[model samples]
Each structure stands twice: as structure tokens, then as C-alpha cells.
Target: MHSILESVKESPGFTTGLRLSDDDLVLVKNAISEHLANHLARIEPDKVPLLQTTALDMYHTIAGQLPHDKLLTRQSRILAQTAVDAIRTTSLFRQLESQLGAFEISDEENVGRESISIRLVRPGFDTDVGSLHADDWFWKLYDFPVPTGKRRVKIWIAICCEQGKSGLILCPNSHKRDWDYSVIERAGMSKPLLSPDENPDKQIFQSKPGDAVVFNYDLLHGGMVTRGERTRVSMEFTMLIPEDVYQH
Candidate 1:
């Protein structure tokens, strides 16, 4: 058996773990649900009784917000703080934090729940499924410089992902080699097209609440549309070992 980080290092750049207990997951999930419910109720107090669908509808309401909205940004920060507290209670997270030194959570654009990436994947809807792509590739394309001795990783926690729901797909061992993404077709900064020959082994993880998938941000990865009738929900956040950590 390999350690989680080792497995991720050897593979397409990701690993999933049920680090949080059932109770822990419930606490976090309830926090999110309550937060959304409160927001909805505050907005329309008279309609609070009518809005019974808290999970999918509440998620969509938050996800549909403009990223720059103060409410959205503040809620994202609150949710991130909630996630950090939940993850810290896990032994696995402590182990990684010890070994990795310190990780700074990213609060920048498209990095939080407000970006609609923390979505309710609906079946047969291209609206929900993100195209196959590497996030860091787009960052690089925009001239984001990643210095030596500093690395960033993204962790996505499943709040309610189930089997056959069309979860995340990643190309195995693709991160081991730095592909010439410039050679791939691209219309803009969003999705990068992969050549047929450039394809690698594809992998997907069936996740449940409290399960988390950690991956290199540079890895080829994206979500698939939900195939099951039940909606899938998840939240994502990134952590980077800042350059100062290497100086010590």
C-alpha cells in the first residue's frame, strides 16, 4: 500500500480519501446547508416555508451568484473556514500539514465555492460539466510564474457525490511529464483541446460525503455531467506551500 501523496505522485496527479468521519461529514454538510438556508430565508422571509429544496436549489442559488459579489465572496470565505476546521480535525490532514510545512489557502478568483464549480451536476446538461483541462495550464498561459521549491495542490471534498453520478475524470500519470500544451488546440483561456495522440489513461473516483480528492492543479482533470437522477455536490479549495517555506 502506498501513502496518499505517493499514490498521487505516481498517478495522473490525484488521490481520494475518506479522511473525515461520518459525523464530521454531517457537521460540515449541515453547516453548508444551514448557511445557504439562512441566506435564502433572509432574502425572502415570506417564501422561506415554501423553499423546502435546500440541497440542490440552495447550492444553485449560491453557485449562480456573480463571483465579485461581496455576499458570494464572504460566503466563500466562511465556507472555506468551515472546511479548514473540518479537515484539521482529521488525522490525515494533520499528517499532510506536518510534512508539507504550511499551506496557504487561495482566496483568489475561481478558487472558491462561489465560482459555481461547487456545483450540483445535473444529468445530460453540458451546463454543469467542465471540459477536460488542466487548471495550472491556463494559469501558465496567463503568465503565472510558479517558482521552484513552491508547489500548489487542489483538494475537492465531496459533500454528496455518489456512484454512477459521473464524477471527476483525470488522465493517469499525465502529470509525470510536462506536456507541450501549446501544441494543443485552444480557443481561449478556458478549455484547452487535447490531441488524439496526447491522450493518456483516464481515471475517475466515486466519492461520498467526507471523501476528498487531492490533486496537482496542473493535472488534466475535469468533472463529468451527472448520470444519476440524484444530484452530486462538492466543494473545492487550493493550498500552496509558499516560497517562504523553502527559505527556512
Candidate 2:
């Protein structure tokens, strides 16, 4: 059998038992739901009672505000704290250094970024999906320097995802090699364009509420939109480790 840590070192990424409790789940769901409804009440007052975001209304104008939403940023901090607490259940965060002393997880984003975000994926083929990409590619695009002695990794926890239905799509083992990309400048911002030949050997990792999916910063990943009805919600955060962990 392949070991978990070894799997992370050798492949695209792996899942862990770390999870949020039932109470935490309720807290996140309610808080975000109310927030989204309130966000719409400002412009579309009649739709407030629609219980949107949970069952998304494609016409809801809130999608334009996702990138800079302050409430989402604050919530990211709160969720990051939850992940740190959940680490007590597994040695993955603290004792992980035993396997690769070059890496470490700070309790907060003291050095890099919160990089924490909440996402809702509505089901159906008509739903818009994110382009194929990797987190670090954007980091480089923005010229954000990874702090010395720290390398980045991503943490994604399923807040309300349906099993085998909706969650993440990762390109297994794609992290080890550089994926060819071009920069497309728009609105004074540069975005990474995945080259045509560098397509992902996509792997759908369906996760449940509270399940944590830690993946490499270079991993080619994206969301899996479902034809089902339920909307998928998930939390994402980032942490760093010693820079040379992967070097010989």
C-alpha cells in the first residue's frame, strides 16, 4: 500500500481525515447564506428570501463582487483558524516536518497571504466553470514573492459538497513538471493561459463536508461542475513550508 505522505511527495495530491465538525458546518453555511442574501437585498430586494447561493440564482449580481469581498476575506481568516485547530486530530500539519523538515505551517498568514476563500459551485451544464489553472501560476503573474524559507501549498475543505457528484478536479502528477503557459493582460492584470498541449489528465476528487484536500502549489487543478441540482460550497486556504523540501 502507498503511504499518504509519500503520495503527496510523489503524486498531484492526497486527502486527509482532517475535517470540520457538524456545528462548524452549520455555522459556515448559515453565515455565508445570510451574507449572500443580504448582499443581494441591496439591489434585488425581492430575491432575499429565495435562499440563494445555496441554490444559486444565476442572475444574482453578487458574482461581480467575489474577488474583493471584504466579508469573504474576514471569513477566510476565521476558517484558517478552524483548520489550525483541526490539525490537532492529525500530525499532518505539525509533525509533517519529520518527513520534510524544509516545510512548516504557520498558524496564520503572518508572512504570505490569507489566500482563504469561500466558493459556491452551482450544478448544471449551463453553470460557468473556472478555467484550468494552478494557484502558483497566478502568484507569479502578480509578482508576489514566496517568502524566503517558505514554499506554498493549498488546503481545500468541502463545506457542503455531495459525494461523487461535485468537488475538485486535479491533474495528477502535473505538479512535478512546468506547465507551458502564456500571459494574457486584461484590465491591467495578467492571467496565466494554459497552453493547448499542456492539458490536464484530470482526476475528480469528490470530497464530503469537513474533508481536507491538501495539494501542491503547482498542481493543475480546477472545479468539477455537476449536472445535479445541489450547489457545492468549499473553503480554501494556503500555508507555507521550508523552500528546499523538494530539492535533492
Candidate 3:
């Protein structure tokens, strides 16, 4: 793992990333596409009218009806959960531990402590082009504090992205600094938001299908518009270890 991290560190972007093989990528993509299709199919015809609505409104409405504990019923949700679990227990995660330094998963019993969360982000159906504001606040509320020596990383997998579709864009290494929550609050007010250049040090990542990108939590990031004819689909998850490391 250290070798992988070292290799990635040698790059200017400070990101060591890889795409899933063609076969695996295809399988994952098919699974997600079918899952989403089924979820939409489950909606009553009368409700289909509502799905035409913007992403933010649709997400809020679906979120209200689908509790966090109940997200597993959807195929996309199940896949996302499985991916997170795999990373948590695999040698891949252990390699990350050595490269990033000691880390621990959040204690399940602790309230208000930063912990892992998985979310399914499907553009177009539940949101429109300008709905990026919602994610700005979402990341702010979930950020957990870490000691000076360690990094807080958030990982995302692009399970399904049609050719030329919009994927996620992230500023790499931006997590090395403290997050500026005031920017998020101000953006929520319909005020002018900072440009991506405001954080030039950040690297923007656009993934192919089945590609995974991991970055520091404090790193400024957001969804990008899908340029292709197809809708953009992806999953995001966060990981953090306690300062003591053994607490988990």
C-alpha cells in the first residue's frame, strides 16, 4: 500500500487513482443502471410526474420518504454500502492506513462524532444544473475534526457514468487546510459564491465508469454538470480514524 501511495504522491496531483477493469466496470455499471431503473419503476405512474422535478427537490422528497436506515432497499444503495464495507476491511484500506498514518473508523456509539456516510447522487431525475449548493452544506455539517498530523479522507465511486456525462469535480489536497464553513453558509443565502480558482491548489477529478477517487474531507469538492445525453450517477462515502486509533 505504501508503494502505491508513494507512487501517487510522486505525481503533481497527489492522487493515486485507478479505474476498474473493463469487465468489472461493466458489471458494476449494469448493476447500478438496473437498480436505478427498478427504483424509478417502483414509483407509481402518478408520481412519475414529480420525478421530472429538479434534483434538489426530488432528493429532499425521496429522502423524507426513504429514511437513512431504509436506503438499503434500492439497488444503488446496496452496492454503495457493499463498496464501503469492502474498503473498510480490505488490505487496500490497511495500505491506506500505513500511507496516511494511523487511522480508525469512528466509534458506532458516539453521537456528534464524525463518521462514515454513503449517499447516492443521481443528477437530472432529482436535481437540475444549479443544485450544487445543497452538497456544499452537506459536506460542512459532516466534517469531523482530526489531529494535526493526520488527514481526513472522503472516497467516492462513479458506479455509472454514460459516455461524456457529467461526473464529480474535486479540488485535491484542499483538505490539508481547515474548512471555511462561512463560505458554505454564505452560498446558501443565494449570494455570490467563490470561484473554483479561489482554491487553485485544489485538483478537479472527473472519473470514468467504475473509477474511484479519494481526497481529504476538508478538500473543496462538488458535482459537475453532465455534458452527455445520459444522466450522471455516482456514490460517495467518508472515512476517518480517531486520534487514539484504537477507539474503533
Candidate 4:
């Protein structure tokens, strides 16, 4: 059977309006719901504080890896290589790489290899805000050179509780330029750009469970605060391909 990613590549706007089929969406939602329930059930109320503290530390570390100030916690891997492996084998992710013509690498050790970082964000553990700046740690850590003619792509998977909370908003086509490191460094210098009116091409992805949104790395994008009672959970990662990869 054809994979979802393969199917998406055959259609238009695969990068923009990519969504899961009804059956697939239901499967994703159930998986996410079960995962959360299991984790929550296993945690003791007394240990919750410790878990929150550890999660915060992990969030800061991951955020530092990006060129932004803050990113919503979504999921994590025991090792970086594990995350890389999942991205490589996942049909949805492969389609993304193919659509963007991203660089292919054998493993995480490969300099040009694409990678995905997993994080988990839970309610009460961290506050949800409409906007947050991304850090430039990935460029420095991964040795991804500055953006010239082309840029990398970042995909965020809304794994659980996708009721519009924690959705992303982006300035359309901004990835065609250089990375905006200054925006992250000066995160609170001025009010962070939150709403979509700031740019007409701005697109907000209010994904359903299991839905994923991919955007150019250089694109100006940030997280949206959740107002509902349920926690907003998702996984985010970036795809780094050489400039020549996308040249048609």
C-alpha cells in the first residue's frame, strides 16, 4: 500500500495543507490519547513536581539548540540518533524530505544528515503563549551553514490533543532569506509577533490529532497559546538539506 507521505507528494500544496486521512487521523488520535493516559497514570502526584522540573530543563536545552528563545515542549528521545532514525524511516517524514528535495545522509554522524528533535509539553508544567522565538542552536550544533539560495524545513507533528491549542503561525515564504537569529536573542526586547495580521501571507495551522505542518526554517513562525482545558502536545523537528538539493 502507498504511504501517506507518498500519497501527499502526488498532490499539490503538500507542504501547506498536508493532513491525515479520516481513518489515519483517528488512529493517530487514539494512539496519542493512549500514550498520554498511560504516562499520566504512571506518574505520582508527589513526583509530578520533579518531573516538571526535569522537563523544564530538557525544554531549555532543546530550545537552545534552535535559533529561537522558546519552543513548546512536545516529545523527546533517549538519544539523538534514535530521533534521526525515526525521521528517516517514517513515511510521512520521507515524503516531506522528498517534496523538499532535502539532503540524504546515512546517519546522525553525517554532517549533512537531516534530524528531528522530540519534545513533550504539558499544561501546568509550562504556560502556553501565542508567540515564542526560536533559538539558533541547531545551526551551530549541526554545522548547518547559513541560508543562501535555499533554507531548511521544520516540521511539527501535533501528536496529541490538537484542539487548535499550541498550533503554529508562520510568515509565508520567509525562509527564502537568511536565518533571523536576532529575533530569538531579543525575544522580550519588544512584544513577540503573535497574531496573523502582522503579515498577509501568514498562515496558522490549527491541526487535528496526528496532523503535521512543515515550514521553511527561515520562515518566521511561533507557537500559539492554548485556551482549552486539555493540554496541547506535539513533536517538532527540522530537515536540513544542501542548497543544491532543491535546485530543479
lDDT of 2 at 212: 74
What lDDT tens digits, residue by residue, belong to model 3 across residues 1-248? 34434322333323546445666555554444444444554554444334434242134345444432333332325443343344455444554566556555442224334333334444453333232222324434445244454434456666556544566665555444444333434323322234543543433465766677655434456666655545555655445534333222
- Compute each candidate's TM-score over C-alphas: 0.69, 0.67, 0.51, 0.52
Query: Given candidate 2, what's the lDDT at residue 240?
Result: 71
lDDT of 2 at 66: 43
In terms of TM-score, the best-performing candidate is: 1
What ranges in model 1 sit over 4 Å off? Answer: 38-92, 98-101, 110-117, 141-149, 178-197, 242-248
Error of 1 at 104 (Å): 1.9
Count of backbone clashes for each model? 1, 3, 8, 19
Instruction: Give lDDT tens digits, candidate 4, residues 57-157.
Output: 13333333332222222222212443455445555654655565445432233434444433444443344443433323345544546545543445677
In angstroms, how far off is 149's CA in candidate 3? 13
Query: Relative to the unseen true structure, what is the C-alpha lDDT of residue 171 in candidate 4, on a scale of 0 to 100?
Result: 59
Worst 10 residues of 1 by lDDT: 65-74
Query: How do the residues 1-248 of candidate 2 rate in per-residue lDDT, one tens digit apiece?
Result: 22434555576455466566666666665555655566556656764555464244242234444432433333333434443344434433433444445344433434342334567666663334456688888776766667776767677778777788878887888878888888887435467878988767987776777677777777888878854546677767666755555443
Using lDDT, rank the candidates from best to worst: 2, 1, 3, 4
Local distance difference test, each candidate: 0.59, 0.61, 0.46, 0.45
Which residue runs of candidate 3 sit more than 4 Å off their true CA positions?
1-14, 37-42, 45-152, 162-165, 183-203, 240-248
Residue 41 miss distance in model 2 (angstroms): 6.4
- All candidates in order of TM-score, best leading: 1, 2, 4, 3
